[model samples]
Target chain A: MNAPSANTLGANAISAYSISAAVPLETAAQLEETLRHIGATRYHSLHPFHKLLHGGKLNKGQVQAWALNRYYYQSTIPIKDAVVISRFRDRATRVEWRHRIEDHDGDTGAEGGIERWLKLTEGLGLDSAYVESTEGILPATRFAVEAYVHFVRDRTPLEAIASSLTELFAPNLHEERISGMLKHYNFVNPDIMSYFSRRLTQAPRDAGFALDYVKQHASTPAERRAVCNALIFKTNVLWVQLDALYHAYVDGHVPPGAFVPAK
Target chain B: MNAPSANTLGANAISAYSISAAVPLETAAQLEETLRHIGATRYHSLHPFHKLLHGGKLNKGQVQAWALNRYYYQSTIPIKDAVVISRFRDRATRVEWRHRIEDHDGDTGAEGGIERWLKLTEGLGLDSAYVESTEGILPATRFAVEAYVHFVRDRTPLEAIASSLTELFAPNLHEERISGMLKHYNFVNPDIMSYFSRRLTQAPRDAGFALDYVKQHASTPAERRAVCNALIFKTNVLWVQLDALYHAYVDGHVPPGAFVPAK
Candidate 1:
């Protein structure tokens, strides 16, 4: 097996299907290490195009393309989070993941990550109503995002949170995005970047709890592998978003009916 | 906006979202003309890459990609047809579309379009079992197909049949597909082409009845436009199928974690 980047699976190594584990558990730490390895090697922030996106090398069309495709992911995160919330018998676990939902849907107005994402879309000249309507998201993005929702709804709650262990790598993502977008795109402002800023603080603290629970609860080797594989699945979800974005935007091609940024 | 693709809006075209006129008193010829127009302008059979696909220009990967992605569509056809069948007010329409489900699903063992499609997948080097499980199909394909099922499940029977309007354009697609595969790929054989031949014989005859029903029964301009718009939306659904396939296959870009064709 490959050594995990950053002692975890970061973004660079994405497996189409996670390696099924068939091993004895040495200890909880080793299981934790294996899961973290999945995060360090396979998490999404490492996609090259995201570097371009955050670094501001992309044009307004590209930025609009990013936001539009990402909207599919943004709109569904709450639903996935809710799926986790619905399954937890442990109120503490439910209470913990509940923050993730609140973090996305937010409270009243333009407060949460989703609303903040709308601001980013608005900054890129996309209509907020259209962005919210999700009329313009890539078909792949919608499919891929909904698949994640299905996973949470259908899988065990522990597995659902395990899927979110991709967040264990989020602090690093926030770091790169903050500096990169500020450097690259003139349209980006710190105000619009507040969404990531919040996620930056929130994701790791949240992921830490999830990681702790999985390592402690997922006792058997197979169970631990499922936990690890769930994060890998989550990374693929994020990675596919970039795939759709790159095919539509960076290649100077959009599918026949996907979002076309303003000329 | 761009003159609507060489087809002028008919003098009788509904000008707004307002309710259309009461059901037109029309000959069967008029009913046939309206559905043919919908097929010519709106069915996904007219999509560019679909034209490319059925014209024998697609590479093996492209065909595999189509087969893989389209398995989602083909598999869902029976389920959606079942939804439409369930909506039948009369024994006649239900009996008619019941043949559609039976034709796609077959009576027993390896007989239906679903089974024939597996033969095509086998020819493409995909495992017949995995293909049947449909575990690896693109999420976009799943959602678009499921949305079609849900549309049939949720809407009035007229709109449900309206959604099937894509079949109005299918006879030519089936021919193009059979000829294209036989011409382009050595792996394709008569057994694999059985599905297309069957669809060629069935789609138009089925479409003929539905079109006549819609034209005769959509008494008001509102209902007529609803049917037309329903057909248009069905086209969009079908078009998105190709859009996802092209983005994934023609472009050699699969969505993150979707099935990858083996050489």
Candidate 2:
């Protein structure tokens, strides 16, 4: 077998390193620190598009593309949560998780995160039916969101939970997004931005439980590595969507048949 | 329900039209014509990346990105086929479909299509391990591929079979790819291009059976439209992968962590 190259050392390197060397276990605090470090360096908040978005550099059309594409990701969350819930055999564990479904889907007559997201799309002048159809969203948006669902369905339960740890960084990004969009764009308002406002609270609560679960359950060093890698994977899942958005909308090379902002 | 708009007519307009009107049934020959129309218009061979790659306009590195990104799609064929197989209750249908799995993943010692694809990547100088890890492929590649597997797993069996109808156009593209790449690039060799050579025969035999299956089984107009739409969906799956390639490689905006063509 070939030696693990020096470049193959972090998240993507797990498979290579797992075969050759023992990953040293971290304490709970250390694991938390490591996860935080991943958030610091790898999170989508640091992505260039987010910088452009929050800095008021993008025009309204660009912002519309972001909202339209992101709706695809926002809408898939409950489905991902449900897949995670299905994987758990214990009723109590599922009961604890069922709140996530409620949080996204909402009770009868109550507005949910998805409906709130649609309002944001509508605020940007996207037709509600078009946004709901997801017909015009970028291919990368569909792929990234769908990957999240499949990951939860297919990964070990621990890794699935660990992937959710990206939520640990979510509240801060939501804060940035809400304040930035409201301040910069004429179209933004409190009602449409409610999704971010709601997520600011919901994400932290969800992330806390997930972080605690992952830290406690991923006891072995290899399992810990997998947990870290899963976060990194989740980060990529978020990051790549933005990358596609930046390439298509920002760089102006939108693929044929994808959403094109009306000039 | 709203009436179907004059604009909402073909494969893409199904969801709109389905709610509004009774789709007129077509004779077998007419149904075949519609499927062929979808192939002619929507197939990925029409993608710019294919034109560049086949025309020898792309450098070796750009070619490498295409091959590596495409490896994800090629490798998943067996898994998608297996999902389709699992959906079938009849032993005869499953038996007929099992050849797809076998074609992708050959018997012991006889290299399958996937392995042959790796030889193409390796010929372009990518490490076999990195290629297999799929760590470096485009996110769109993964999403498009996983969507395909999920579609086969979750959609009705007839729709699942119809999605495979993109193969109806595959043999001709494979022929073009082989001759064009051979004529242009010194890096292209018979051994590396063997995957296409093999598929020239295999895809036709497979597409023939699938066409017959879909043509015979989709007895109603709605079902036939669904079959046509499924082909269109599959074509989009293929087309979008190339679109991602073009956006990233040709347009010179390789997403932050995707495969970078070596200078």
Candidate 3:
């Protein structure tokens, strides 16, 4: 198959159904390489929306639309993690995974990633209540985010854990975003950007753990392929969110009931 | 709220959160009126995609995209109905509901709705395996269709049954579609259109049962409101699928991985 462009929006580019592993990799190291390859090629960082976003070509309203729609994805991570945790019977695995939930939802009085994400939207002049409500976000955003949650809830424990492997690619994107938005968008500040900053450290730890788990556990070739497929599915989940944002905000074909940015 | 146009694409038009029942209706007649009102404004029959489809403004490729993507929705109904049946413990309710599944899934040798739908896709020249695989349908279609399945699985049984009330409006749409497509597109024929033709009778029976169940069970104002909200949510599920189709196929912004119609 011809190599897909970085900017191609269809998940078909890295479809889970595609039998990419006709000759599956034989070692954990090879499996790890395959996972990284999927990340490099299919991750949302390659989406054109990210290019427009990080390059600061978008107006405040456009950026606001991005943040608002994305808030659905951000808020859903803990719930997805909870579903992931539920998939495991092993107490140790559950213990390890439950912290991911805490990292997002937080302990009493401690700010979690979701609360911090709201600060970004809040900094962008969006009302936190409305941001939390998720009422005005794009329908596509709701679908994609729910798709992620359901993926974790429905897939096998290994596949669920592998889906989290997208976090392996998150740190670099987060770094690019923190620096890019602060550099380009005047409305963005370090405090509002704290979500990505905190994620820089949090993501690597999470990704490392998930990566090791997938490699150690995916013993058979078909199992390894399922792990790879899960990562590809997760990337599609991320890529489609940006695609929807680009179609609605960038192309200016926002559906009737989605958030309409201020004039 | 301003009166939403007959063709508004957003579910926010009939938002379940909108507190439409400021003074809850005093009788089932009033509640039924409110539901019919929601259908009049918010049902997917009002979507411009449907208008384009039924009015014969779309090309053969566009109609094919509609049929192919719609097959996902068509194929999912039995699974959704099965989930609905799972929600009930009563023998009468389960027995009543199981027929809905049979009507779609069929008995051993009997033909079912989904097979009829496959005929429509096959008639349009889509590969039966490809359509059944659902590999080429829009991401938005998967999300919307799965959203309906999850809605039935997750929501209260009353809310679940209420979601099916969209069928109350389906008979008219099926009539319009069968006549419209056969008249406008030479690619469409009466044999391929069997699914909608059959639904003309089946939908009314299903709708009558569901509507009566909702009216009898939703004795409280709050329950009645929940019932209305479920219908609105279902309409959104249906409406977004078309919005995605319109954006991808008609507007020529098909995402990288979705079905690309033959030139």
Estimate the TM-score for candidate 2: 0.88
B181-208 per-residue lDDT for model 2 (tens digits): 9999999999999999999889888889
Report how far off residue B229 is in candidate 1 (Å).
5.9
| Segments in model 3 whose C-alpha atoms lie over 4 Å from true places | A1-13, A16-23, B1-13, B16-23
Candidate 3, A50-142: lDDT as tens digits = 998999899999999999988999888888888888888899999988888899998999999998998999999999998888878877778
**Which candidate order results from sorting by DockQ in descending order?**
3, 2, 1
Candidate 2 lDDT, A1-263, residue by residue in tens:
64332133454433311222433445666567667766776789998899999888899899999999898888899999999989999897798889988887888999888898888989888899988888788766776788899989898999888888989998889899889988988888888898899898888888889988988888886788788878877887887788788878887767656777787
Residues B18-57 of candidate 1: C-alpha lDDT, one tens digit per residue: 1124323244444455556656655677666777776777
User: Can you write out model 1's per-residue Cα lDDT over A148-226, one digit (the tens) per residue?
Assistant: 8777877777788788888888898888887888777778889888888878878878878988899888987778767
Q: What Cα-based lDDT does every candidate model obtain?
A: 0.72, 0.81, 0.82
Top-TM-score structure, candidate number = 3
Best by lDDT: 3
lDDT measured at residue B52 in model 2 versus the true structure, 0 to 100: 90
DockQ of 1: 0.23
Which has the greatest DockQ?
A: 3
Residue A250 Cα positional deviation in candidate 3, in Å, after optimal superposition: 3.3
